[model samples]
Target: MVSVALPQIGTRLSASPTGLQWVVDAYVLVYAALLVPGGTLGDRLGRKRTYLAGVLIFGAGALTCALASNLPVLLAGRALQGVGPALLVPGSLTIVRSLFHDERRRAHAIGLWSTASGLAMAVGPALGGVIVAQWGWRTVFWINVPLAAVLATTAWYAVPDVPGTGRQSGERDGDARRTGLLADLDIPGAVLITAGLAASTYATVVGQSAGWGSAVFFVSTSITVLAVGLFVRRERRHREPLVDLNLFLRRDFLAANLAGLAVFFAFVGAIVYFSIYFQHVRHQGPIAAGLSVAAIGAAFAVAAPISGRLTHRFGPLPPLTGGLLLAAAAFLSLTPIGAHSGMVLIIARFVALGAGVGLALTPMTQIAVQAVPDGRAGMASAVHNALRQQGQVFGVAVLGAIVYAHQDYLTGFRIALLTSGLVLLAAAITTLLLPTRRPRPASGRSRHQ
Candidate 1:
């Protein structure tokens, strides 16, 4: 999000379109690919320990990204930052879940945590914009340093270690003991998956700009697909696979993950472009543009808690469906943004979009975690994030193609908004596959052995 001004910055680069796409897409791709493994590592190590390490790495990466002078350097640093987030975010949630064992307390804790995250995610763009406008784009990444420091220091003292009762317990009693869950990881499978994902992203970034028939694009895409196929084959045979293949057989788990992809695809693809449209078409300055974009986060601040409460009362259907519908409606409203749309319309649409995203986030994460057993929560969360990051990358690839061809900022954004709305609506429809209550096996145990 700190790189939301990338379109503006790309003009200063050697390869404008490709560089900009790589800037955003590379970060998301690395984030998605590494996330599951990072969480698995957390489960093996202490969540607190991994969480602290992830934060420190993330902070350092952020600082590195801020100091970057060239596009390649910036991208490398951003990649590190992206990987760090994949670790920290899931670890943070798992930590909370591990700490609060009681159902009621966990529910409330998760709700608050969701609200805060939604608010921050929603507001992040605006904050980035303000910093970018006032100081420069580099300053956007710099702000992360102090905040991360404060969090790490305070949490070090305050946070109690989550007992290793489940998966973590399988690892304890120190070294030299390799038990069932503590079995050596399928490191090859992990490498294969990451390389596949990264290569696929490279293909996406290149193919849209250069023809798909281009040598580099075809080689990259082919290698990616080949690696993925090999990864699946390897995981199926491995004693302890990185991603347990059987989880997809569950309809609920599958639905939640698919919906997660659709939701994030819409968000990253649309929101970032909208920031550009606000400034370029509406003739607004960077600050006003960022604020207009950030309005969604403000709406999230209010709606996230409400969505959680609604989920508690009526299950995810009501809020999830209604929110998606409202978001679609808001998006449809934006289709008419011609050469002269008023401020009111923009604000109204932004507010609606914000609320829609707020409703989505918690429900999405909740569904993913609930789909798996308590022990597999970290892995499930990692999958959820990875799928969504894929969605975001896909969105960028798809919508970016449309934008590059059109070259009219407003038209491109409306197309993006329309695409986003459709995706969320599809997600809302997909929610029907989600079980209203976590299904209990007839024999009353987790489906896993």
Candidate 2:
């Protein structure tokens, strides 16, 4: 909804390109930073309770955004909204982990999750357009109000409560106590990663505006490096770390996350340019431009479940590799697209892109969680989501910078598509190297720990 209405927001707020980018990045920034702690917190508390709390926060944020009188107020509202997804996303996935015992069934459920997400993307633009056209941009935020209410109500009644495994019988007092809220929260680790990623995001945005060699960029980048370094060191030494760094030892886990990050990096980064091209270059209305991109969502919604089933049967490698290749092909197809390109060509490539995303995302989600012990499902889910969202921030910022640098929108669009294609291709090759077999537990941890 925010993506579709960004142009309107920019126009009304008299925003520069950098300000527009912040409208999107601000929400994603906080979401990515808080996800690890959010997931771990949910695991310590209860998934359903955490999830409902997130919904309420999201609803309140939406209300704040709808009522905002200025850009700063809007950004603050977006920041608040970010907190909801941090808690909501992993908690929802943890619920899936709780419900499905068999790996195959879990994969199928995750596929459904991907499909639903795709469907929302499909409908969002058109829905948002109608709301924006009728009631103005503020109404778009109001739409989330009813939706969140329904989600919260249904979830409370329908979703089962999953108890925390923070305390188990026959464990040493120290080990069992480590699972408690205080020990598991990993506050110092969370603070470091949050500051690091925030600095990194700020650096990218500032570098584009103020030049990469500017003092602000240099300072922010330095903070990013230092913060990230301290985060790694702290996680390695901390008991009950926010992210279990040891999980990366699993080939499947590492590859799937890397691949997922690449895929989102391409998708999110490229779409902002697509929106820009349609609105600025082609002079299309927001609704028309959004509808033009709907092909990807429609295709993804249809394909994701099938891909999930395939992953369940043949392992993640085949679908993941094939999907990346398909996405790369789609990106290449976009290279020739210009202000005068025909709708048919654009629609075809969008469908191809959507299919690729649908095919790959489910398996990536499946692998990230499956590689870990059931006890760590929430943390694993959060880590995957956080990386994926971080990839979006980088993708949008970097590609937007490329677009902003070029006077010609076509040149910038071409560069972004080509760059995204290269990334997808690289991910494809990486997918080929991922383990072909279903993951067994790493670290000798049993399912229940």
Best by lDDT: 2
| Per-candidate TM-score against the hidden true structure | 0.88, 0.92
Task: Give the true-structure RMSD of model 1.
Answer: 4.9
lDDT for 52 in candidate 2 is: 88
Which lDDT value does model 2 have at 95?
88
Model 1 has an lDDT value of 0.73
Across 180-287, the per-residue lDDT of candidate 1 in tens digits comes to 434576788888988887887778778877876799999998999999999999989988777888888887778778877887788767776776676777677766
- The candidate 1 region of ten consecutive residues with least summed lDDT is 440-449
**Candidate 2, 1-449: lDDT as tens digits:** 78777778888888787788788778877888788888887777667778988998999889898998889999999999999989989999988988987766777789998898888878888778877887888888988998899999999889877755564555421133543546547788888988887888778767867887899999999999999999999999987787889989888888889998898899977876786788888999888877877788899999899997888778888888888899999998889788789888889889999999899999888889888876788899998998898788778778877777788879887988999999999998877657667644323332343
Superposed Cα RMSD, model 2:
4.6
Error of 2 at 307 (Å): 0.9
